[model samples]
Target: MYVLAVLSVLHLCCSSPATSQDWPLDCTARKTIPYHSDNGRLFREDDVWNYTTVILREDLGLIVLGTRGVIYALDINNINTKKASVKWDVTDTQQTECTYKGKDQEIDCQNYIRILHTIEDGRIFVCGTNAFNPMCDYMNYTEGQLILQNDQEDGKGKCPFDPFQRFSSVWVEGELYSATSMNFLGSEPVVMRGSPEPIRTEFKTSWLNEPNFVFMDHIPEGANSPTGDDDKVYLFFSETAVEYDFYHKLAVSRVARVCKGDLGGQRTLQRKWTSFVKARLECPVLESQLPYLVQDVFRLCPDDDWNSCIFYAVFTPQMDSSDYSAVCAYSMHDIQQVFTEGKFKTPVTVETSFVKWVMFSGDLPTPRPGACIDAEAREQGIQSSLDLPDKTLQFIRDRPLMDQAVQPISSRPLLVKKGAWFLRIVVAPVAALDGATYPVMFIGTDSGSVLKAVDYPADNAADTFIIEEVQLFQSSNAIKILRLSESTGHLLVGSEVGIVQMPLSSCGRYKSCADCVLARDPYCAWDLTSGQCTAISSAQTQAKRKLIQNLQDGDTSLCPPSEKAKMINTSFVMGSNVKLKCELISNLAEATWYRGDNQLAPSDKHHISRDSLVIPNAGSDDAGMYTCWSTEGIAGHVHRRQEAEFKLTLGTEDPIAPQARSASKGLVGLQVLVVFLSLMLGILVGWNFYKGHFPLPCMQKQRQSSIEDSQADVPGVLEPLHCTEDKTTAPAGNSNNNHTDLANTVPVDGHATEESSI
Candidate 1:
């Protein structure tokens, strides 16, 4: 087992800076909006519990939040506007039993509302992990209020017993299609649909083995097909691969489909899906065979054009610990082609050791195994799935996986982030000023920040620009959910504590045309008429105004010339320091100072920082006109723009007077004469010490006593001034002569004090 694991690990390893992904061009949000309370008071952090689920009611202009022990309804335009709320709590008996099972009474024993699905007639099917025993109900919204209809429905199959486990649900025609575990331990993962003759996937490793569902939705295939096909309920999830030969438990991304009109088969697949088929969703990695695991998925299908349906998903590596995440896109046409024409994969036990999964190349049956009851099947006397032959049903039950994998659009990821683990995604198609439709994606990350990017699909090129990243939460809490409001052009983001609503585009944040053009956001452009950066709408694009936008390559030729700061003349005192200021607002530009076309060198005399240039000990040579130039690179092209300029002069304040100059000359002469006199006095003392006098011995004794007394008070800066108190009694001739020589020397410079002891 150890050797096999090592070999499997060596099979594929993600290379740093992989060529399969594009380089992420980073930008930051110019403005951020945070949540506030509606009652004109600061919102308490604990007022709202963990936001587990969200419902985007675009029709009713409301956004509903499912939290612990309560559900809130707020205005879609403003999340701070609380419309209504409904509280639902569990009993003490249920909490006590939950704690007895080794769960925390405060965290796990509380009701964490997880399921919030919009039903018909302004009603929502709500469910929660009610203290380890799931319960569900319905609630209606009318007249700006949410009222509970009932709480009697058992939520075993509809909601997961563990609140933190992964699951997903979608409602179509009053029946909820959910993918979750059925038991408390959550060992059995199933894709169950609500009543009106309910059916679920088979509880087998080949069917829905250890799946973690991220998204589920249905598409009306009957309306689009000319042969009267059944509608499809698609599921996007990740599960342990049952068709691999690897040693480790390899997780593969899957796109599963089931017909909505199907019922259980007669003899085989009893009360289980007869048309269940799943295929691996492939996202090509550079020189690697393994695909990334699906974390979240968003389906964008236009109401006017159903054939233009696309599925955007977030993927992360299955084995690595890095925060490596990617975004991949798929079209509905490719997904349908794979499911309709793909081969079957069947498992074969080899050598009585392990099961090896291989593609089944044998001939298929008439009225294909997993085909919905279409016009061709009806012609073969098959009106419903139950009427199919037992051989056909058995073939599909055993071979539930399709051989051909569903590849992403352009056969690669749209965008990849090395440092961000994307948690949720919402994409909106915005019309650019160039008369083309671009998809703008708002992706949430693990650092409480939201990244906004634009995808330009031109000439079969996958050019993406990360326009901005906005921090929605004050704390470092991961954003759990994201919802886009088309009516109000607002984005609703949810973290652990609160939800905040912000506009999709804040073009006003860009103060200059150059800054706006460098952003490359599809929704923003520079207007020449108003001299302001404004949001570009479809109508504005149709009008064809003087909107300066360069999505393919950032071009600023049409922008008006910027006005550089006027040169201000200033005089600095001699030997004083000066700093010249050059303020700029461009984050992507580098500022440099120049003096008369020669770039200033940063040395001991001149220091250059981010916003200014400092000159220490200014001199006449340093006096000159200086200019600050900003160099910015946009779309692989570099451009220089002048920001500010200044003129400086290094000079004295005023000229000296004639009388003061004369006084300074006199003082210099006096100092010179004092130095000459001190030198003569020292020479005379040396001559006296060389020739000893006769009768001056009596005078020498008196001088020695006087010198000894004065030595105690004299400073020791010139020579040895220390003497023993009994030196007079032992008096040596050398010691007396040394004291007499010191007394003859006179002090100079006058820096020494008379009252000092050595």
Candidate 2:
């Protein structure tokens, strides 16, 4: 039974064929951008190395890249030109001071630039972990050069002191909101709002417990609010939670928000956030119902308000050894609801001994402590969050975490992968055939590949279709960042080695109409006029453009029919091996075999594979008109067409006989008898003519004479027959049909002769 089970599994793996629906679209990069200098001879000292951050400045047509100890500003219009790069390096004095701090010169002494955010004055704010001592500076563009500003500030919470530590920050309205470790040792972590008077969460375990920040974004005012609300900054991170009953701490993904206008509390939480509230983020797998750990989150919105914003997050299994990863999407409305109506978890003393965390059911403060200062609050003579009463602020500080968790848009993930670990995901809207825009997600994996997919609205939810998988980098380096430029129709891929400029759509990669249509990429279409697969936007102007596409229904009618294949005929001897080959044009189409009108199935004597059909012992029963079909679609309503046909003929015996026989012994006996009867008839006719009468005795005497004459000629015929029979006989185990035929014929001849005489 175990052997049979193993054989069954092996058969499935080996015999499973590739079909058009099951085959994944594969693509390659059009161009690659390397971090190392192309013109090393000219600019020996300048090298754009270790690209940790990539920022695109569309207004200036420049791509600013941050690396260790230096910054590079490349021309976005043409990245290959060497003269277009502007390099800015750290000063020698700063490097000397960084080295004197007893940090590793090679690893930690050099600046690991991590922060690159745009400021209000058209300048860029830059920060780096300067040899474990964080520092910040400004970059201004002037006369084709990026000049570093003289003024510098303490990075602290704005940037991580350790180069390898995870941190996230966002700049909104000239202020930077960041989540990072604020110390050189990397033990003190904080989420703070820096610039224009810095204020942060209380430095306590209750606020942040060993949190690893992933992303930060802001939602502008008056977008989804019925009563115009203040702008809000959202931070996404994962941290060890204290609410679980297990002995070990459980890791939980969190969505923390703070009012942009928050000015701290007046008394109880002075100089600290009064509107900081966080909730758990849940993304569970549909099959296992296990929540995945959130690795990265990307907010897809350009407007000031998050009215149409959706956050796409990459999650992996909680187990470190698991290779599964998934992508989940959360809408702004659901996140807002979780923050507004969700209950809070607060420490409460129960029964006899210990204090435990439970849901707070007491009456909340009047102005809603965790809410931003609104116009009504201003009208009530409350100037800022600072003027709010201590009771209202104390409720927010004590109950930072909500009891309810924020759920994703769908119960299951948008896409799930088995072997690849997704590190980043970005979504962009692409125009479809019906003038409708659909969200296309680009997921970056740790193995240097990107998977592009589209989500379409189905019955009551969305269905995901993976468009293509593209390999951007030759090396298997992790894709740390992915940014899409809608205007240029290109994706900016950043890795530890360098930054890559990849076009979002590679329509020309598809060679056939069926492949183009089956890919289901909204950005691409098969242009019949040009006989090529090209970008949809480029083919829109062609008045006679024939596009073969059906994203929803997967219709392939638009594709041209495959050319008719010629028929093939084969002949094989009985008991010999035979193989019939079927050449299929499309690997995506399913191949099947049919003998005449009946379908043929694989059996012990016959084997059917993806490309060929084999018969171990060819017999007369196997002779038939066989046909090969190429089919698509599901069973019962499949679209099938004949691809090739074969006429098979099986011979009864081997064409090359060992020995030859002129005539069989039975034929020789019959010929001799006919000659003897003719002679006897001649003699009987003469006697009848002479005597003028026919006598029965004379006839019998003539017949006896004819039989004796036939018997005399039989020995001559049987002599050669016996010699031929001796040669035909073989070993006892061998099969000899010649001797059996001769033996059966002699008996039949004797019976016929005896009946004739009577």
Candidate 3:
């Protein structure tokens, strides 16, 4: 059983279908829209650092970017031009305050805008790490410029005071729910509600552990819920869990939720969260039994119903030097089940250690301590979360870690990349030829590449394939953010240097039908009417079309049939060089050479390449049918063949001798004289053979006649084994020896005669 399991794993790693990394994707095939300080005029002199955050406002056709000490709004429609941008920078006084805190003036003292949220009434709430002292301001868009609002607010928890600190925030209806360090020294981290009223988690370790936040979003209550069911904000982060007994801190991914309508606890924990609860988010690779650390999460919703939403999280292995990354998906139902049905871990007394932890098995609070206050609870004199009792608030605070971990929808990750660390993920819906909406994932990597892939529902493991891997930046800069613009069909990529906008699909790059089919992209299909590979949406108008696609089975049947071989006959003189041209139409196919039925092996005399065959020093044995076969493997183990055959003939005389004589008169005279001398020489040779002075040339052939008779029925006449022309001429003093040498050089059927003196 162990051997079988090892063999199965080996087969999966070695025999999996090829990914985009195996094929080279042309970067120049797609259009690139770049916006940086070099081209854009809105950038200040020192605004050459990076575009850390990107937010796309589709309705306004704008791309709002956050960088060091500056914020710029770029026109998406005219992103390449300099005049299509507007910028805003922090004041010098704000920079002075940041520098006074002993921060690096060049690096940390600069305003790194980390938060930008779109609030109500076309206004944007912006915040920056103003040299460790975080501050927030409002901006209103006017005639190409963003004017600052006068009301400035404290941005302690909303943005990380240190530029390198990890944080996440989300704005819902005008309030900002954030998870970040609330102090300048970067020690006190908290999850807080920063608007309407200042409510936060307690500063104790039980309430908030040392955490690094990744993402935050709000999930509204269902339409069929009770009257007082409030919307909940979910925060995803990785925190050090204190319940574990290991010497080192164990980092665990967490999913915490808070009710939008929660006021606070009344007495025991006043102005603090009463409904704050968290559960462990488990992302483990089942085959390896290694838990992965959550890096980022994206919420995917098919429609307006938030209940059906699924969270796609990117995770990396918990090794010190790991190269693998995976993408796991969690449904809302599974998350809710773990939070409600799972037990809680509590502290217990132990003599071996100063602190002890164990699973709690006791009665829970009424209506659930972490649950939102419904109409039934309110009717029982519980108006809000503030009315909850001390025992309930203490249980909720002490037991934030669940006994059971929340598992992913699939036992394994949807896709696992071997060499890349995924940083961010975004899904876009693409309409296929079958009229079904398929989700295309655009994942950003830490190596400045964006991988585009499609996940097929029918075959989860085999059908999920990467379509392309695009290098967004020339340098190996990590991709900071990725945002999709459905209106323009472009994906905006943010890196440390600048921002690049690239089209999601580049169907026109694949010029041939086989390439179009082998790509296996859901958005691309070959159009039969226009004879071009085009996007599915553009080809939908065509009356008759063929889509060259099969996600699981790489179907290349849609490619045009290869042309049949046209047989051609050619004759070459002995000791001459010849080249056979095999015109291969498809670049994807492999070309091979064959002589008759057997495959030709590589030799010094015979040369074979992709499209042509060469033979030097033509001989009688080389005068056979030569074939050039073009073959390609598609999908499974199937192979398609295209062939070109040539019938060759070797002769003592040139086949084009008559044409050469007719073209030039000097050539005809020389040929006539040579033929007359050859006849006289033949008569003398026959007289000598009749006289018995010299043995006849046919006499030596009798010894080898038995061996030569077997090849008599062959197509071409066989020549002597040593019938080679010698360029050297003998002197006049040895005329008889020269004549004998010349006679011996003349070849007979399959044998060479010895020289004889007269």
Candidate 4:
């Protein structure tokens, strides 16, 4: 539990910087025509049932299915043109007499019968709910619909008859895998794809009390097989926690898995459900609400590096109360071990101990092809079941981590943590445009707004989570997120109104334009001409400036200490452009630009960058301290770089900044004025004290001198000027002595007062 508590703690870890000026969440990048399947919305009339499921095809086009069961192939690449804004109609194949087509359908072509479809191998596989008609009919036997054609009860093709049923289908390795459970009559959970042979797992309950399949995703390859180890699939569902006269009080979240080869075959008899372990996922805050319902699970697939095998799910314990919801996550590797080892043998419910989890160090390595090591343990000749120990998988189950806080339902676009093991991404809300994406996140809102973001630390989690509306549509609509190509960095987003495409290179990426210019990250960076993020030559400028800074201070070295240790000090030729970046740490610090020994005038070129000095278009003439000092912001602070000489001697060039005489004069005058004011204040204080008002110990001598002169000096010595009352009390000896001293001081005319104060 200590490991669990510590792992759950969310630490503020710093990562890389951002690179681009991302689009606002609500701006619509592009618009695509949405095709609805039926005349009315799926359930609500106002809510035009547009796309419900969307996936990018292998060739870069988009395949989306509307809630009304209308399937469309949006030619994303053709529609997303940069300069031209034109309208194009999407090709529809709904009118054909295809399998799963509605029966008694008038030529009006408006009846609702189909569900959704998965695209693969140049053909579309479709399925639908037989709830209204209850009969699976209408198929064109020749086209090979590949789905919705099961003949278990009779040779005629039809899906297992079950209403109130939820199903999901995905194409894996050119074949479709459908996860479906029966509520009307069947006793087992089924995974099929129109094959007569179906893989089944028995976990029966009442008809109305049917279980709901929540989510499914792929796991790390070759880690949990007996002989032929392959990538496995994960399924999340809310099953019975306890059987009773009435259905169980709560639906418990459970995890299940099926191998690629085990999809549709004679594996029905053997309950070889690899990861069929049940766990009670409970959020203390959400468990006490009404109509306790499980929040939908969102699956994130890794981009390239590590296989996190992580799945995110949000649960609203009181389904009736939307506010009381908590987001919970679990790892598939952990679930696999719990089932394979048979640990914690108990029914599922929302309890803390139900789903044991683990976190891997970095991302899990992808498995090799044709790997069957995990699948060989069950064979009689196998030496041991734990022959190839997957420490990474076991590690995740033992020390799983969870987020401490749950974000709002429609937060920001989904963003992935840089270097995070799982394909982690954040989805958030934008203004109106449904959503946008960088690479990792899918951001959208329940209110028809969305933001798609990748984990670029510079953008920060708070900003990344908010969906920036890329393009606003005319009406409110739900948007689907898509990352068209990582290599090209194209984001394709589609809403009920239209489709949008944007090239997101800047988001959370580069720390500064100089950094981007140096690293050549294909993201946002400094452009001299336009002064914006654009494609340009970055290395030449970065290298020259880096060389100059290294020669001067060696402190601006971007390389780590260990790497710098191996490098030899060197110099390079100055190119056409260079940048001098001077960092001022304090907010109050003012940076002054200088060339050579003379201070340069603060010009447009000598500007303060984000906490640093930027020589926008640095030329040989513009070399130098570019010294930025903090004189007053945080008082008495002086940060000066004296040897900051940019020795730019052209074929024949004289010093340029005799022009900055004004800056130099101003600085010197300020210093002199400060000194003069101090002396004047001292003289005024001395005079006041002699008159017996606000007297100071240090001015006592001056006061005594004045009194003595007033008494001793009468005609030539100075008269003893005194108050009328004090004259009577004045002694003859004191008066005479004061008059003499006053005579000497009077000749000076307060000269002594001025000299002493100075």
Candidate 5:
């Protein structure tokens, strides 16, 4: 237990996040079910045998595997935090016939396993190769054992002990219809079902040479069935269907349908099952590449609205040219016509060959498709066995499941089939990075490394597939399988070493990064005024410009406080230099620097730093309320922040920017003189005749000529004599208007002579 705990901690430490410059910190993985086992421990070490086949039953929610002919059922759904319990184990009862003394040595004789098909109402059926030795009657299971029972109850048919190497079975209503091979090398192909085993079919020629059973699924509505009813089971597999003249060297994928009613009874075994006829599946492209090792089949998804059912398949080739060896597709209504016609009406012939796809789109075909090879051919004879109906020979056609069995990054399309657009995204298998939710594609190479990428769409077909290669997982063993988490969207990557987890959110940050530049995205821009990355909006540019102008104007305190504003402490020593910081609202109309009530002057020491205030040679005068006030038109109101209260005790007798201080005093004197001059100039401009003249306008109007000499002022006041004013009247014009002379005369106030410049 202590060792287990230590190993767990070690595993965590080893899977830590990547440090600087390490790319692909996270990646996807391929794992076996044992990795998710309870206690997280597999069978006692040295158990190297892998599972030959696996079955997932929805009703039981159990994952059952055939390992060395021993059945191990893991109720995966009953997991406590990704930990599964080993529910049941079935051992081989036939192992007693072998001479092996121990449990470990007896495992080799049991091999070549297939999945279980539910027969009739409740019984489950499975079969495997007995290693071709009559002594190897005893097989192995995980928990219990099963004895080989070849002797029939009634002994009606030849109960020859047949060891099926490769086979597939489908259950309709209650009976099981099986296609199986006879020998390990694959010699004959035959169809048989049930104890009464009514249904039987066989073909004479080597029609299904090394044929792989791909799929068996129920047909939905609108399927082109000969009976015109959609209630049928379709079978998909890869076979060699050659005519007498031509070399049908190319792989042929075929589709055959069987009605649910034809599964059982004596008539099925006796009659030559021509009812299991096949036709070439139609594809738009010529020379389509056939998928190799047409292994597993699954129902993708059904769309009742479109009258369509989709299927998916896995193709793992022993020999492939490119990294991409998997293919997925669907069947369209128009393509199904070839099956109904029982022949390829027109094969899209090209230089490249073709094969049929067991799984297309998301749903499986009508019949349970065979995986690896047609079980009927294997059951009849061996790999050399044939299962061709007479009518199928006339077509002598080719079936292609994919294009270019292996596709390079450049040649692959963004979409695969006519209906589904393929996105060439590869998810990396690196630790922590693998489990991310980004839509990624993962490529497991022949070498140990796994490549992860984003399928960024290119502008056209000629352009290469744009892949954001995010990570690479370096392992020493081949990747077995990849499981994507549907909920968190994290990729659970499994390798021979262990499993790795990567969250998708962390991956988006480096989506556009190149292989070399991911570690150092150092070109990050910060606009001080906007307080965000410079690429955000136009406000950033404007704020940046304002910050520059403020610096030029010697206003060093530029950066504004954060929204949840707080004061930060920063200072320099008095002896050397000091910085008094003030944060001004950016783009403000005017900011005042105040030391108590005295306003500050713009100088080198009092100027703005890049975005802060820098003060050199601190002095007492530089102390007190160093505040930044902004009053821009846009602000609608003034804002102030007292950035610092510098109590500078002069460390040095001398001051920096002394000329600036002296110039500022001079400016004050000039300002006072200008104010006085402005007042004098206003009085002079309004005087109309003289610089210092002063008079009350009301008094002047009253003293104007009244036209009567003896007018009003005679009551208790002295009056001037009008006759004395005429004494200096002009002589000749003398005779005229001597009386008017008094009104034109100037008033004298104790002066020697009176003058009227008026």
Candidate 6:
């Protein structure tokens, strides 16, 4: 026992947050459940994996998944129930040619569906790596089956050549807008819209500079726009910084925009975009450290008003063992302010060769550069992009970068998680019982768990609460995509193995009003009619006495007093052991034992284990009414409730020691086995350490990854180290977490994220 206690302390001292995923801390209503196993529906395939591209058609109650050479449509109501499937595989000749180009036949030479999105007219736009010969085709959904189009288009800029490249695309107004590499070697990256001759970014590094795109979405410019601007397509990515000087190349996150109606330049840029502009996205604008890189982005628009939209993104630091992930939000108003009125950054030669980005301070053009041909520009006779002057195009072509960075809404990170790196984010606006809507954030982490957090935008000072966390995937595989369906109240989780449809809430798990109200779950409320905790959405149809909830303040004061706990009688002889058992429903609650009105403390004669109160040598004073109380802190209040009560008397009885109720013999045998196994493991580890088989540190950097040129450092797909797919196909175990970082933390030249535990 002493050795174990010493080892526990030593382990705590040696452990770093960067090296491991600690238990969720400071989170109100923190409860973890295997909700996926008990309630989720999974769809899997034997030979096919990598279900990265998932398109949900809530209207049809179906979810379409794009995998290796095949697309499967599954019923959203039950993911395990397949509705339809279609195959579009790579031919043997294509595979041969891809292998001749020195690509891995099994991993890289096979077709992996990279793009699957709804185009127009209920049709779908699909693109695949197609064995390194990128090709795209349209599919028509008719009568529950996919009809593949005969004519195909060259997917140079529409789809990525490498399956593991960080890629993104969006379909807007019947046109495909994409951000990906244009070559087999992934050297030429472009952000372009598909057309006969697509208008794209310049070939120069000044425009993109080794970018790894994560997300792209179309945001329509509403009538409220002061300039009546054209619709916009925004891109989120991390790229190598051209302006910073550091020991190694620094990577910075950026939010770039392109007008949806932008056409290629008239003369100076020819086929290049004239309205493409990008600005730095500072998650936390701090002079002391570099900003975290964007891993995934989500846009939450509660209503039809475009001004109400908010972009929430997940971020991770470049390198070093900080074991941290951050969440930041940016308003569309702020993003537009930076791109429209902000100063442009131009590349200027500082010395003989070094080039740096500096604010361009020069004469302005007749039509503002990077401004869409909106009502104002149209009234000025700038009818279309083709009619724009060569002078304006030249200015825009030379300076596509912005100087004033777009900081997060509050100029600080909304949440900085220490234990796990958040890989994906999706927000759902849930109407709570309080009549106010709350944006509940579902964050996917590196450990395959989904964290449900609630943010109160009305009150910025109110702390974001992580209400619950649930393991959605059985394996340790990371969650690459998280899609929330408000209509169905489900969160669709996509991993390498398959897809899982998890319900948003399970309120029946909380039996008491205190537990229900203290949960503060926007989806759940205490239904007074049924006299039970239930989901508000499901209970709306039934007649109810009342529905009560307190989201802003998890006020237990509003709840009726907790029911009295029944007392259990137990008699024990003096000098014998006395044990009172208590079961904890919430791990966040603090448990304390009291005898009558006095609190019990651990002494030589008494001890309190996790689930029980033990008296070593029972005395007469120990014979009294013992009650176990649970106190939980929520929304600035301490809510206490009785969990169990027991009364002890001075007489020998059958159920004397509750701990010994089942079988003292079995318990002793299990304890001995555990001690024996622990001793053996310790001896073996010590022997290996003495033999110099390994280092003293629990984990040490095994090898130093060599630096590559800017082009060589293409951040791998879903990059940021472990945030990507694990090298091993099936995980070794379903354990919640493991220690240390990925082998090569940052293999890319422009590292976006560090996968050290976080």
Top-TM-score structure, candidate number = 6
Give Cα-based local distance difference scores for all models. Answer: 0.78, 0.72, 0.71, 0.36, 0.36, 0.79
Give a tens-digit lDDT track for model 6, residues 57-141.
Answer: 8767788889887898888778888888999889899999999999998889988999988866877888999999999988876
Per-residue lDDT of model 3, residues 1-758, tens digit only: 64355334323331243342221111111122232333212222344667777777766767777887667777775455432333445567866877788877778877788888888787888888877788888877677776777577778888898998889999987788899998888779898987667889888887677888998999987356757678899989887877776656667788988888888888876888888888878765435433567888989888867778889888876664446677778998888777767778787767876677677888887767787888878888888887887888888877766777888765556776666688988889777766677878888888777788776664333345666676666547888877788887788777777777777887886676755776668888877667678998777766566666655455766677646678889789887777898865444457788888988876898888877888987888899998888665433434455468899997677544455667777777889999999999999987765442464444334323422343353222224234345445546674443133222333456334333322
lDDT of 5 by residue, 604-640 (tens): 7676543345566655555444544333221022234
Residue runs of model 6 more than 4 Å from their true location after superposition: 1-29, 222-226, 285-288, 457-460, 569-581, 601-623, 648-758
Question: Least accurate stretch of 10 residues (summed lDDT) in model 4?
Answer: 82-91
Q: How accurate locally is residue 496 in candidate 5, as Cα lDDT from 0 to 100?
A: 39
What total of clashing residue pairs does each candidate reach? 0, 2, 0, 91, 121, 2
| Error at 245, model 5, angstroms | 5.9
The alpha-carbon deviation from the true structure for residue 583 of candidate 2, after best TM-score superposition, in angstroms, is 9.7
Candidate 2 per-residue lDDT, tens place, 130-174, comes to: 777788989887788888885889888899988888899999988
Q: Quote the positional error of residue 329 for candidate 6 in Å.
A: 1.1
337: Cα error in model 1, Å: 1.6
Question: Candidate 1 on 1-758: residue-level lDDT in tens?
Answer: 65455335334323233454543343333233342332111111366678758888888888888888888887776676789988888899999999888888888888888888888776788999998788888988889899888766888888988878899998889898999999878898989887866799988899988899999989888886898899989999999998887768888999999999888798898778988999999875443455588888988886545578999998877766434677889999999999889898988889968888899999998778888999988988889988989999999988999999998888877776556578899999887878787789999887777888877764554566677777666547888878788778877777677666767887887888887887788888999877888888732845546888887777888889877778888777767678888776655567899998999878998899878999987888888899998887755688678888888886677433467679978988999999999999877775554233321444445445545656676433323233234334534655644434342333446422222234
Of 2 and 6, the candidate ahead on TM-score is: 6
Q: Top model by lDDT, which number?
A: 6
TM-score of each: 0.77, 0.73, 0.72, 0.42, 0.39, 0.80
Candidate 5: 10-residue stretch with minimal lDDT: 512-521
Alpha-carbon shift of residue 272 in model 5 (angstroms): 3.5
Q: After superposition, how far is residue 413 of candidate 2 from its true place, in Å?
A: 1.7
- Candidate 3 — worst ten consecutive residues by lDDT sum? 22-31
Q: Model 1: residues >4 Å from true position, as ranges?
A: 1-45, 285-290, 537-546, 565-595, 598-628, 636-639, 644-758
